[model samples]
Target: MISIELIRKNPNIVRASLLKRGENLTILEDIIKKDEEYRSVLKKLENLRHERNVASKAVAELKAKGEKFSKEVKKVNKINDEIKKLEGVTKSIKEEINEKLLWIPNIVHEDVPEEEDKVIKEWGEIPKFKFEPKGHYEILSKLGADFERASKVSGARFSYISDKLVILEMALARFAIDFMVKKGFKVFMTPHMVRSKAMYGTGHFPRGIEEAYKIEKEDLVLIGTSEVSLASYHSGEILQNLPLRYSGFTPCYRTEAGAHGRDTKGMFRTHQFHKIEQFIFCREEESWKEHELLRENVEEFYKVLGLPYRVVIVNSKDMGNAASKQYDLEVWFPSQNVYREVVSCSNTLDYQARRLNIKYMEKGKKKYVHTLNSTLVAIERTITAIAENYQTEDGHIKVPPTLVPYTGFGEI
Candidate 1:
């Protein structure tokens, strides 16, 4: 939620930001009017309450003097009733304003490039194939990996990652987790099912609700990323630690409801997949620093895996609703002859922590903590990158050297 104080103080700034996000400024203007009305009603209620108190005192003094006070007492009671009615109106208007403010996106960072980011650096070379390279679907089919069998059991956009692929997925996840853990992140395997509060706290609800799988009976939703669970785990709590870092591994589910006919053939867009997610809660002053550190960690992980990848800062229009600033790491896909986004790092600033009430107590002060999250690895896409970038001439997949120990094989 935007700070109402900020909105009240600088409506112009708020209006400009809303315009940048392509929001309906009419809604914000309505909120401004409603806030004014609410304030007027609140003043009326306070004055009436004050008058009632004075009248009650007069009634008490009259009774003490053994004089008639029934009329004054009745007037006070009537004023009290009117104040109660105005209070209800005030409460309703306040709720209306808050709901409108919640829908507003965060203001983009000033330093974020106004234009789409250009690749600043690239690592490794796109693997050259002796023979025509096959996409993951073809390679998996030859290895007897069965999406058809998975579909028979669970329906489309599902797969049974069988044969060596299952091991490969584990290797990818384990390798990413280990890499993050060594970099001061506390590793965790978080819950898969989260309450609606968790979803809203992470800014997944209200915006991405349709893309989530809700457990209506339990009033819980399957998380789309471990970032959701990890970021919201400390919701409504005050952190004693200044910089709380957590890296989580979990199986995530999404409906992919909006992507009709897109990446429909393979695991490129799936209903369920494993992910290693990085989440951080830090002091507001340190959030941007942590954001870059998170990006560097992702880049180093991919670099160690010998994947050709580059980092690009996301543009405002494409940064989504939650992220104030975002950076994406796109790995080279040999078959596609282009880079595809595999990891996203974002500084949500206080956008999420304010909603979650995840705050921290400084030595002598209290404030909302800033939150940041990044994808260390999403298993399906990472596997896709590996399959395409590390394919051998004879159709075997080369396991990245960093994951060799985890998979217990040099090649798959």
Candidate 2:
């Protein structure tokens, strides 16, 4: 949640940010009104309590003087009743104000390009086809991939990536982990099930709640991205460095409820997918620099796979609630003849850290940590891109040279 103090101090800034996001300005106006009303109620409640205390002292004095104190006692009792009623009202109003404040998005960074991102650089070249090529589904099925069986066993939007594809998945994951480790990140396998607090801490809950898979029995949620668990791993802890990098490999679960009927044909969208996620905690002053480092990591990973890709800085309107600035690395999909998003890197600044209470001591002073996250590899989408880009005109799938050793074979 954004700091209400900041909003109170500069509502115009908040209003302008909401406009950029195309959000309802009335929401901000309502928050301001509720905040004012809550403050007024709090003041009244405080005054009532002070009056009660004064009346109680007067009653005590009357009793000490051995004078009839019945009238004073009744007056003190009336004051106490008013204080109790006001306290209840004040508490309810404060809760309502806080609940409303949680839905607001973070302010967009000033330097984030307002226009659509232009391709600054390109890598590799698009492979030309000599014969008509088939999509991944057709190619994988002929090689004995049993997605139908997977759906029957686990329901729709599930798959059993058998044969060489399973090996390919592992190769991709291992390749990503090694890449991140070389960049000084401590690799971890994070827990798949996280508490509600962890989900909200990463700014996934309260905004994207409907898209998450909830475990109603344990009141835990299956994480949509490893970033959630990785970011929350240091929750409430204070660090000393400006940049602390961590990588996590985990199976992410999502309802994908809102994406109904879209990308439903292939692995482009799924309820569960394996991901190697990269997360960083840094001081506010160093967040933008770390953001570029994270983007470079993704770009390098794709380049090593020998795929032609481009990086685009996402505009403010397209950035989600948690991110102040974002960029996407899109790989060329020859089948679609367009670039498809494969990885996104975001600089959340202190938006997530402040809510999670993730902080650090910087130069002998305390401050909220700035959090950033990027995708190292989402296995399914990466596989989709690879399948489309590296498909043979005959019937084979060519594995990238970088992943051949990990797979123990060069091609499938």
lDDT (0 to 1) per candidate: 0.84, 0.85
lDDT of 1 by residue, 291-363 (tens): 9899989888888889999888887667767888889899998877888888888998888888888888877
lDDT of 2 by residue, 322-377 (tens): 99988888898887788888888999888888878988886688889899999989
Q: Candidate 1: which stretches are off by over 4 Å?
A: 113-118
Q: List the residue pairs that clash in candidate 2.
A: none
State model 1's lDDT: 0.84
What lDDT score goes with residue 90 in model 2? 78
Q: Top lDDT: which candidate number?
A: 2
What is the lDDT for 244 in model 2? 88
